[model samples]
Target: MGAAGDMSMRCVLLALLTAAAAQPEGPRLISANVGIIQVDCCFNDTVVDHGQVVFNLPSKCLQLVCNYGKIIPRFLGDPGRSHCCEFDGLLYAEGAELAGHCVVMQCTRKGWIPRGDIDDCCKHCSVYDDPHFVTFDGYRYDWHGYCNYSVAQTDRTYNPEAGVFSDFEPCFGGPSCLGRSTFKDHKHTVISLGHSVFNLLVNGDPYAVPLVGAEPVRCSSKVHPVLAWRNGQCTMLLGSSKLMVQHCRHRLDVWAHPTHADNLDGLCGHFNFYDADDFTSRQGDVHPLEYLPSTFPHSWRTLDQTDYRCRQCKSCPPPRVERLCRADERQLAKYTSICEKHLGSVIDRTEGLEGYLETCVFDICMMYQDRRNDREVQDWLGILQKNVNMAHMIINLRLGE
Candidate 1:
């Protein structure tokens, strides 16, 4: 009995080993007497026990786990592992496209991929305060003239759909302030601001803000081509372009789409990306920086015989010396401290910190030169400070998109 039992047991063990060797290499299954089977998963040349998690995987967004001899992938939802891209504090899902002020970005698994032509969006130009003009190319200059001037105009041969005219007048004891702006697109839109009241005119008829029209003249309160009045500011949109007029500040901002890039001729300058060629004359000649004070601005002046303001476009007073407009060291230090505290980050982002500081110094010097009482000077300075703050807010609101 002992010899036969031993031989049969040995044959059974040999047959089990042969069967295991003949099978394909895979998870090793161990059978226990309690009828439980333990399975091990093989992944990347490493063996993983069942129900064990593998944290350090190739994709940070995914985690691998061994379950029943199979490798299962699980999303970790780790903060560092994001399938979306964040822009301007907003999250864009993967494969999503976002079009902003000057750029178009697409969200990918890795990050945000910029797509399409970035120059497709509109560019900004503005005139504010004592008539400081920032051209579409970011050139800053001042032109003082009491006349109706062309702010922007499209060469009829080019687009024939866009034009902007501004009326300059003496106001707030300053040399010039933009009192009225006439925007000529498919429909004639006029914005007149006087005594803190803004009036809108469409084709010689009085129209209110948020007016809606058909095809060429579309203005709404919600969508594009919006004409809305809010917070003492009137915003007018005309075919992918926008114009904003701020009451009591004499500020006007123009956002022109890329459609009018090289086809524009006026005080707003050519919409080309280069600031050096911004001072192109109405006669179609690019002027140098030296002409910014006189030749360039005077070139865009309208000589309309029927308009009284156009007749007064005589030679402007001699260009004021900027050096003389610099404030004293003590006053400059104080103003600089204030500006650094209030507008440092904003101006730096806008690439206008140095320019704004210089403007502040000039304003201080001019205020002192006027020989106003201390209280009046402080009041004027306060107004300037408010304007700077407003500019900061407006930039963030408009460009944060």
Candidate 2:
């Protein structure tokens, strides 16, 4: 076999080992390909993990589908009103892993929130799509106008209606005003699709440069934190930010479209944040899932929280706030009793829980390839849910009655 094939096998084994060590009870997720899962035989767990009660696994389970259910129509957030037709009885139908590790079998009070419905039953709520700011793309538009990419400047000029974007740009697909250039301040080309990458890979030809790794820089992809783009070279450095969180081994997002990143045949990378920044402005904030945990308002949103795809992406995710939902004095006794019964163990357990929650964030993003598109989203979600359910928690979607 070629050297590349040997290397791929080695990497797969290494990843499996690493995951087993990290999560003892839960299986580690692996994408054999975009639509297909690895389906490792080792991941069938005999123990069930639940939210109200915590349980650890006797052994490691790799990848497996644990739960399967179609979303009830009222549970899913629709532009206008998606009748039961929209609510297919399947989760992880398309893009990703199951829900969280805790709280199995029911929707968590703290679980994902969707918005927009006519009345309570949403028999009459306006469609999820609005004509004004909503674009053909699914990315969200920021109403606060604070979404300008400039780190320092506030009132800078940006043209949203520029021409088409070049292929091979490493971000949300569709057209964007990539704010100002890290190359030059106030220059629009910084946000131009493939401009930064083209400059980095210039043989004076953008397309001529083959994808350097197994992955191509597709839309919905993340960048390294400190990306130095100039003179056709992108020196990616370690940065915690979404635009540059890559591990240097570049690959296409699970959602990388067939054919190319952009070029409207099927409209694959069309819904960039720039594209959808304002689509739901009149309806909801269309918060990126990454920022869903932040205390952003969701008056018009379909759910109070977003989907795994939205939560996992780095699209300049909203600010994360520290939340403290203090236990009322009345209920403190219940929690206190447990804490007192297992004081030292409780401290350790709490710390472990916090650690898992942190890593789970990335798991969420990596789970769904193209999470925003409501079209046939259930299939994508169903697969992910099955994976999650097998190793992690039981997931449920609930609507306010």
Candidate 3:
């Protein structure tokens, strides 16, 4: 071979090596030699040991269907809604370009495949593709928003038979300015309660009780007060407001009932007012389930004389008010009566109640006191209690025999 030819070949080889070294590490070459890409970007690439593939998406554009299904992406033109479709262990990627768009897929023997062009992964509601907002139960909202106020709402109906609500109506605003819908809020409220109850039951009360110890645990039940909204103010649900001294015996109870700390000094009250801040401004705030009375106090009166007096004294409205209905009174009366008539010895017959109450009251009280200054903490406790109550209702429904 000639020296000129050899020199040229060496120069060409050097140039190729330099070009390869200059390329950025982020993008995949997508050539025969590169079948997978792993970069420090948002996408999480995964190839299961069992030959299945998994990838992380921004939650807005793509979602994983079933655990083992193949994934495919589709793209349409202009404001297109793109998605990753999963089929029999295979994937298809398609891109969309139109606003208010979605990518749809059809299942076939060949694997899950994109349905020609123009179909969407979402029906009724537009696909949520924002970086910060996400869809839960078909409502899109930024979880970071104040008290979940960022959640978007749409007009929809509930179908008890299917155990799920129907698709939401098209939101009037362009996704960002939508208000939370009534149905979505209600459903989410129920779900949130269930989750809180499950956590407390698993990690708070039931597990806190000691199995073997010298201080054998004893649990007792009592009735806690119920508060509701009436006449645009916070008041007792079914109890009367007028005081009955000698002739009228039933107490004309008020908000912040058991007004005296002495009333809450017993075992049942200990759990009821089990706050570390029992001596502070936050006293009587936390009422945990483990410490909740088995029997609930009920009345047919609606006026809140005590709360009214306080409101009148301050000449101000209640700080926070919740919507209430008469039906809840029956529920309150029924649940409170569950263990009411039983003798004090019944605590000995109750299995695991003592331990649960002790641990739950201790943990929750300490937690409450620690965060007593933070109003948000109290808000969280109230929300969690609602969930626990719902969970109890569910269990009672299933095993109320």
Candidate 4:
């Protein structure tokens, strides 16, 4: 129509049409200035300062940032097993102190989170001076008892919800602190089968010594005895490992038939195994089998196994043989069953891959440190985990009987 507004619009539309025709997707034109734009509540740090408000900014800054808002999440890494982080249930690394020692934190969590100690700035893992403690009534437990006990640095108080007994008290004394309540009328028999010796228990006594041609001998009431099973052979204390290993190799697996002891040379051998309570005598002065000096290449002591005197006693007639068939098979199967059950339980209770790795990976690796690389470490870890559990179960089952 040749009107002033119509002429101006025609000129603008003709210029935009020419520019839009050059591109694959045509762009449309809009007014340079528009109505007020909405503000974003959550925004990226790069777009605006975390605390910056769009309304407070100058018009130029607001215009520049008008369409650049984004609600960025706290963490941006892929959520996968490799990205999963974990902390030890009992200890966490805190920043170093001025003294140059790393501080630790005590805390626990059930699942993945962006940060630790969400309720507070500080994060920690519970630490204890003594890892093992007794209950009010006298049951003992270590860090592994997390299933049934709460973490308390020095407090031994029981928690009912956690299944800890209220009356179990902590015991701080030495081995003698174990009273008859733990084991009453204990009897232990050590039958030497020519080169190897087998141990069995009745009540709480474990002093039955086997002979070659005579009846099995029981130690005198005051006589204390320490029995060791090493290299698959059993021996009384004060026997040399070299001689025991030499004689017991051929007869390692054979069960000792009840017979009188003709000579001591036939009885001693390098022991490969032992019960948890094997080292202690009736007098309760000796250490546990795991703590014995032999484990560390130290010299053996007669007094360590005796509370009063260290006199060697004569061997006696063999007692009646009991449970003569498939003893080793029975023992091995028992260990295997206990190990499988406990390992399955561990896997089920663990939350994630990282959680499982944190719980037992170190112990498993350290157990077979002679090996190398990830594959070897993993294989050994699996083998050792099962073996360690089996060994522990054997100890308890044997001693508890």
Maximum-TM-score candidate: 1
C-alpha displacement of 77 in model 1, angstroms? 42
TM-score of 3: 0.15
Instruction: Output the better candidate (3/4) by TM-score.
Output: 4
What's model 1's lDDT at 326? Answer: 45
Residue range 184-283, candidate 4, lDDT tens digits = 1112322222311334232234543343211112343322222222222322221111011101211111111111011011001111122232232222
CA-lDDT, candidates in order: 0.56, 0.23, 0.23, 0.23
Which 10 successive residues of model 4 have the least lDDT summed? 159-168
| Candidate 1 residue lDDT tens string, 277-353 | 88887667778865237777776765432356456645554335333344568877876676566556656766453
Model 3 whole-model lDDT (C-alpha atoms): 0.23
Instruction: Look at candidate 4 and tell me the lDDT of residue 267.
Output: 9
Q: What is the C-alpha RMSD of each candidate to the true structure, in Å?
A: 22.6, 27.4, 26.6, 30.3
Worst 10 residues of 2 by lDDT: 123-132
Candidate 4, residue 179: Cα displacement in angstroms equals: 26
Model 2 Cα lDDT, one tens digit per residue, 1-401: 45775575456545654543343343334555665332222222333222111111101111222221111111223212111110111322111222221111122222211222111111100001000011223322211111222111111122221112111112212211222123111122232223334333211123222223111121222221122211112222111111211111111111111121122111111333234332222122443433222323222121111234433433444444432223355544543443233233323333222222222222222222324343333343332233222112101212111
Identify the superior model by lDDT, candidate 2 or candidate 3. Answer: 2
| Clash pairs, model 1 backbone | none
lDDT of 2 at 27: 39
Clashes of 2: 72
At residue 78, what lDDT does model 1 achieve?
38
